[model samples]
Target chain A: GESVGLHLPTLSVQEGDNSIINCAYSNSASDYFIWYKQESGKGPQFIIDIRSNMDKRQGQRVTVLLNKTVKHLSLQIAATQPGDSAVYFCAEKGANLSNNDMRFGAGTRLTVKP
Target chain B: DAGITQSPRYKITETGRQVTLMCHQTWSHSYMFWYRQDLGHGLRLIYYSAAADITDKGEVSDGYVVSRSKTENFPLTLESATRSQTSVYFCASKWQMNTEAFFGQGTRLTVV
Candidate 1:
């Protein structure tokens, strides 16, 4: 069995502070990982992604870090804002058999306080 | 350009009735996936299709059926809807593995 999980269920931060969301995956064979931001009543939106070959990838205001040796993935949001508040989920894609499938983490709720 | 679209954004069906959720993608992606989102379960994959006429079950596929007659469409049907089948269903499409997937708004199904 494979599992992907987050370090915390919820995170609260100030409007101007930085926020870090951590995810630990159990499958070492997973070669690709993605971070999604989901707002209430909406579908998950693509944020950033990192491959096992790379350690970090940066986007508009978000960065994804991957530590393959430790099977850990993290999403860093710089200067948190009210718009950044959402449930963040990490997903890993792997070749389960002949086909490919993606497994999603439990999700970490990010709440930014004004 | 519409990336992906789903029908019946909100649905309410009976427990024993049959319900089908439609998913369509305009990018002509080869891969399409159906997932249900629950409070504690996160997003669980129910089924996925690699191409037209080719489909496979995912982590949670029981009580559900899927068909990909065309590459642009993937539909998920609940043979007999149950209270447990009530959840927000999402459809996603990716050009290939390790690529970014575009998701539809999602269908909220409530079984009574």
Candidate 2:
């Protein structure tokens, strides 16, 4: 079965440094991808998203890069902060699927040190 | 409220008991989804609804059922809860298939 996966299970970074999270999706037909941030004891919050038509998309301080040929997705966060520490997940939506059904990765725990 | 919300933020039940988690959204989105989060499994889709009376099973749908009687509500019911069924459930809604989805606060269920 096709599934979405993350490269690293945990990431440790110093404050003010840059952080990058990698994800790999097995579904080639997936057209939409999203990055979500989940804090302790809370639901996942939408961060950024990109469509297959675009290779890269940037948000306030985050950038999402999509590589279709390699089936890879990456999220880069600039100037890591202590508050940025949380679990991040990458999700993909297949084009053939109806509605907004999405497959989520196991998630990467980001720890920003003060 | 003006956003997605889940009822009974936390619940504890015995095995074989039936439990239902309620999810409601004010945006009237066309798509609604139910997912469970475990320690190492992240979020696994349980079921989804495209519109009123239109529902489909997702990756981990067994032992669970869902219905979308109206556009603003989608409830997930566990017919026979088991210890393995204990997890944090999240409900999400999006306007379209390619758009970002907003999630509810989450419901924590413990089955003993």
Candidate 3:
């Protein structure tokens, strides 16, 4: 789901369940995308990344999927844990834009319930 | 140790006063960026530098200023602090265009 006004889109899931976060980007030419996990009062931590050429990329218990035609990106977390509760963001950079100028999407808050 | 560092993790200032947030990175990355995170808005870029002294404005750069005089430091300054400027600030750097950016702990600013 997406955000509503000042309220962030929230996803509440049970522990040990799988979590899927989706983001729709605007730039079709974007060749780079990244997913960040940010806990309260802390900076964003890079979780995973995907390039335009790749449909999917995986990390420790996490995966990133990119659909260039639809300009969509998603993050999948396996075996969700309480420690995994945080705000997740998706960033994109087009081929014409520098990677350092990555643009971020409205974050989605993931809450893991015991 | 070998990452980006932001000074004065928390700051409080008057609305009309000027405030500066400091960012330093040990990685010697070629690019540095400043972004503000608001409640509804995710992270929005304020300014960025391709290298030392090559700063450029991002999508939401109004009422703010940034200078990159050295490769290791990039400072963001609010000429006159406003209530709307109060938010968490993050500094990030990337060594190359294809790499992921590393973020600092962040600085929370409050304007009274």
Clash count list over all predictions: 0, 0, 0
- Number of the top lDDT candidate: 2
lDDT of 2 by residue, B21-66 (tens): 9999999899999999998898999999989999999989999999
**Model 3 segments more than 4 A misplaced:** A1-8, A95-99
TM-score of candidate 3 on Cα atoms, chains taken together: 0.93
* Candidates 1 and 3 compared by lDDT, better number: 1
Instruction: Compose the digit string of candidate 3's lDDT tens values, residues A6-95.
Output: 123889999999999888877677888889999998999999998899999999999988777877788899999999999999888875
Poorly placed runs, candidate 1 (over 4 Å):
A95-99
TM-score of chain A of 3: 0.89
Regarding DockQ, does 2 or 3 come out ahead? 2
All candidates: DockQ: 0.78, 0.82, 0.79
Cα error, residue A114 of model 2, in Å, equals: 0.6
lDDT by residue for model 1 (B2-87), tens: 78999899999999999999999989899999999999888998998989999998889999999999999999999999999999
Predicted structure 1, TM vs. truth? 0.96
Q: What ranking of all candidate models by TM-score puts the best one first?
A: 2, 1, 3
- For candidate 2, list the clashing residue pairs, or say none: none
lDDT, candidate 1, at A26: 87
Error of 1 at B36 (Å): 0.5
